[model samples]
Target chain A: KDDTKKEIMKYYWTSLHTTLANYPSLPTLHERNTLYHYVISSASLFPCGDCSIVSQKLMRKYPPQIGSRKSALTWGCKIHRKFNEEFNLTVPTCDDIAASYIIGS
Target chain B: KDDTKKEIMKYYWTSLHTTLANYPSLPTLHERNTLYHYVISSASLFPCGDCSIVSQKLMRKYPPQIGSRKSALTWGCKIHRKFNEEFNLTVPTCDDIAASYIIGS
Candidate 1:
């Protein structure tokens, strides 16, 4: 269950970053807030209770940094690493995370 | 890009359904709302603009039906099929959806 939740989180966050990159311009306020809610609500809805607890704590601590695509992607990668640390899982470097989600140049 | 968006949507929605099935009890109002936002914001954040437009229309037509796990799963499946139909993709039956996400049962 923990591993499954982790996989879901990885996919969802990667998708978010890739989506941000796919857009031609900076996200509008509405889009930024929508992305914020996606991360927060997804954390809250994590199936693993322990993982959700950790996620919620991290949500409060780091929050979501949203604005341009690159900023959002960077923020997501950083937070994902934080979650990895919290779970004691193998942590990916920021460069690796960014590379994994690259949609365009 | 369209195919990538479709695959992301498929993974995210199926994850939601599977997570619902993993939970032992009905979700609280907070949890339900969280799940709803996850779906909405995900649609809003879809990489493909055309897909996002179609997803928003679907959101308006079918607001999330939240209460129990099974209900949420059913609603997600129905909406996903609606999306499939809208996109002219292969549509999975509701039964097939439930079967795919089955946890304990």
Candidate 2:
């Protein structure tokens, strides 16, 4: 059960990174707004209470970047780093984030 | 790369399953609306186009069941079975779905 729980967390974050990295180029303002809300809603609904609270606080401070796909990806990486630090984990560099999340791009 | 891609997909669905299985009891209408929109937005922004299209179609046809967390979980399992059948994969039974996704309850 612990392993499954860990796997779910791993998948959730990786899928989130994949989503942020793959937003369409030249997205409309409405689409960007949708993505922003999606992120907020996701954090609000995270299964873990402490993780949810930390995500909410981070979101309150940083907000969602809606400028472009690149901007969203960068913002996502920075937020992920903040989250990592909350767990006292070593943060991945920006380049490593890009290399890992940006597929075939 | 293929393996990583597969891993991402695996996690994505599992995380989604986890989310649906764990929605708060006595959720407000607003919270339910947010969850419904989250599912729709997630399907639209899925990394793969074909997967996105199929998810969209499934949502359009089936919509979301927000009566309770149990309802959401059951709907999620049915939809996942549909997705599985798309690739000619074996569908997990509803009992298996409950066993897999329902955590500590």
The most accurate candidate by lDDT is 2
lDDT (tens digit, per residue) of candidate 2 on A39-102: 8888887776667788889999999886788888888888989987997767889887667655
Clashing residue pairs in candidate 2, if any?
Answer: none
For candidate 2, the share of real interface contacts preserved is: 0.56
Q: Which ten-residue region of model 2 chain A has the weakest summed lDDT?
A: A3-12
| lDDT per residue (tens digit) for residues B30-64 in model 2 | 88988888888888887777778888899899998
Off by over 4 Å in 1: A1-6, A22-25, A101-105, B1-6, B22-25, B99-105
| Model 1 lDDT tens row, B1-105 | 556665666655555576666543577778778777887887777666777888789889998777776777777788879988988988989888777644323
- Model 2, TM vs. native: 0.87
For residues A1-105, what per-residue lDDT tens digits would candidate 1 score against the true structure? 555665666655556566656543577878778878987887777656776788789879988777776776677777778888987888998777767754433
Model 1 interface DockQ:
0.51
Error of 1 at A13 (Å): 3.4
Candidate 2: where are CA atoms >4 Å away? A1-8, A99-105, B1-5, B99-105
